[model samples]
Target: MELQKTILKDCFILKPNVFKDERGLFYETYNQNVFEKTTGLKVDFVQDNQSVSSKGTLRGLHFQNGEMAQAKLVRVVRGSVMDVVIDIRKNSETFGKSFSIVLDDVEHLQLFVPRGFAHGFITLSQQSIFSYKCDNYYDKASESGIIYNDATLGLDWHLPEEEFIISEKDLELPTFEEAVS
Candidate 1:
């Protein structure tokens, strides 16, 4: 696996070596040894979650606060998506900065987002199946989110605002400034 670091410190893009033939392809999506070597952080994943969404559907800009914050390894198993992560750690130098990548079945790339970052994605194909492993289990009480279209952040989701479909809960999320205050 080849790990490329993102601008936001510990975040990374993991590209696995794929061996293929007419039969199909094979690759190790995650290996603990490689992960520890690459990031220097040992993670114990406790939960795996999957979601399916249609094109133009936006899922996040979500995070967990306090002790419930989760570190995630995300990938697309079917179709494609434009995955995004925003650095939300209050004391970090890159706070408020965002990183994005196109994850598709063909490339088979996985994104590693550490705790203290907010994550979200937009489906780009007819239907997308997204999966992720989290270092921490879900805690509804600690769940929090920022508006996907928070103007102050000026995230270029690679889609027009009107073209995107977001949940009412997401729409009601606070802006960055509001969140900070």
Candidate 2:
């Protein structure tokens, strides 16, 4: 696997080795040992989640609090998406900063989002199968989110605000300033 570090603290873009032939193609989606050695972080993903999003769908800027925070291994399986992450670790140098990447079926790249970061994604294709492995299980009481278009955060998701399809819950999320405060 080829791992590329992002500007955000502890985030990574992983390009797994793919072997192709006349028949089809093959790749190791996850190898615990290689992942641990390459990223130098030991994680045990207990829950695997998958979501199918249509074009223009926006989901996220979400994370769990305290011990419930999830470390995710994320990627696209069937189409494409503009995946995003925000550094919410209060004492970290990159706090309140963000990272974005285009993860698609063609390139087969995966992103590693450590605990303490908020994550979200918007589909850039007709439809996308977004999959992720989370180190922790669901925790509703600790769940929270930042508004996707928080003015202070100033993230450009490459989509017009009017064109996005967001959930009412997401619409009710706190702004960047409120979240960080």
Candidate 3:
């Protein structure tokens, strides 16, 4: 696998070395030794989560606070999505900046989202299966988020506002200013 940096600080895109033949295709999704050697990051994933969403569905701009913050390695298992992240680390140079990438089964690309960022995705295909590995376990009390359509973020979700299918919980998320405060 090759690790490539994104515009966002400490974030990366992993391109796997795929082997193809008449039989089919294969690739190593994750190798702890190689990952640590390649990126110099020491992460012990404690939780694995997956979600299936239909086109127009939007989730996130979410994160955990303080000690419960999580670093994530995310990928698409089937279909496609526009995965996005915003730097929220108060001391980082990229704070308040956002980055986005298309994740799909065809490319088999994975994104490494460091702690101190808000993460989310919008499904672009008929149905998509998203998977992620989190370095820390989840804590309900520590969970928080910025609203997906917060004016300050100015995110281009690539779908019309009327097309979005959002949860009531996500609709009620705080704004970027409120989140950082």
Candidate 4:
């Protein structure tokens, strides 16, 4: 396994060793010992979540607050996306900064988003299957999100107006300032 460090503190892109032959291919997604050793991160994922979305579908700028905060290991299974993570940790030097990566089935790359960050992705392919492992159980009361298109953050989702798709619920999320407050 290869753990590629990202600019964001404590975030990483994990590349697995893939063995391919004339017949097919094989790779190990997660191995406790290997994961802990390579990334130096000791997280015990309690829940696995998967979602399917079409091109231009923008999902979040979401996170769990306080004790319910979750660290996530995210990957794409069937297509591609421009995945983004924003450091929202109050005391961190990189707070309000963001990192973006192109994760797809072909590359089989995974992103590790530590707790205290807002995680989101916009499907770049016709459709995509996004899956993630959360270190903590999800609690609805603790769920919170920042507006995905907040001008202050200046995120480039790389989609045109007609193609962009988002939910009303996500639209109601607070702006970055409101969220930080």
Residue 49 C-alpha lDDT in model 4: 96
Preferred candidate (lDDT higher): 2 or 3: 3
TM-score of each: 0.96, 0.98, 0.98, 0.98
Best candidate per lDDT, number? 3
* Residues 109-165 of candidate 2: C-alpha lDDT, one tens digit per residue: 999999999999999899999999999998999999999988888898887888799
Q: In terms of TM-score, how similar is model 3 to the real structure?
A: 0.98
Root-mean-square deviation of Cα positions for candidate 1 versus the true structure, in angstroms: 1.1
Q: Could you tell me which residue pairs clash in candidate 2? A: none
The TM-score measured for candidate 1 stands at 0.96
Superior by TM-score: candidate 1 or candidate 3: 3
Give the range where candidate 4 is weakest over 10 consecutive residues by summed lDDT.
155-164
Tens digits of lDDT, candidate 4, 68-177: 99999999998999999999998998999999999999999999999999999999999999999999999999999999889999998878757889999898999988
**How far is 75's C-alpha from truth in model 3 (Å)?**
0.1
Report lDDT per candidate. 0.91, 0.93, 0.95, 0.93
lDDT (tens digit, per residue) of candidate 1 on 74-145: 999999999999999889999989999999999999999999999999999989999999999999899888
Q: How does candidate 1 score on lDDT?
A: 0.91
Query: In candidate 1, which residue ranges exceed 4 Å CA deviation?
Result: none
Residue runs of model 3 more than 4 Å from their true location after superposition: none
Model 1 is weakest, by summed lDDT over 10 consecutive residues, at 154-163
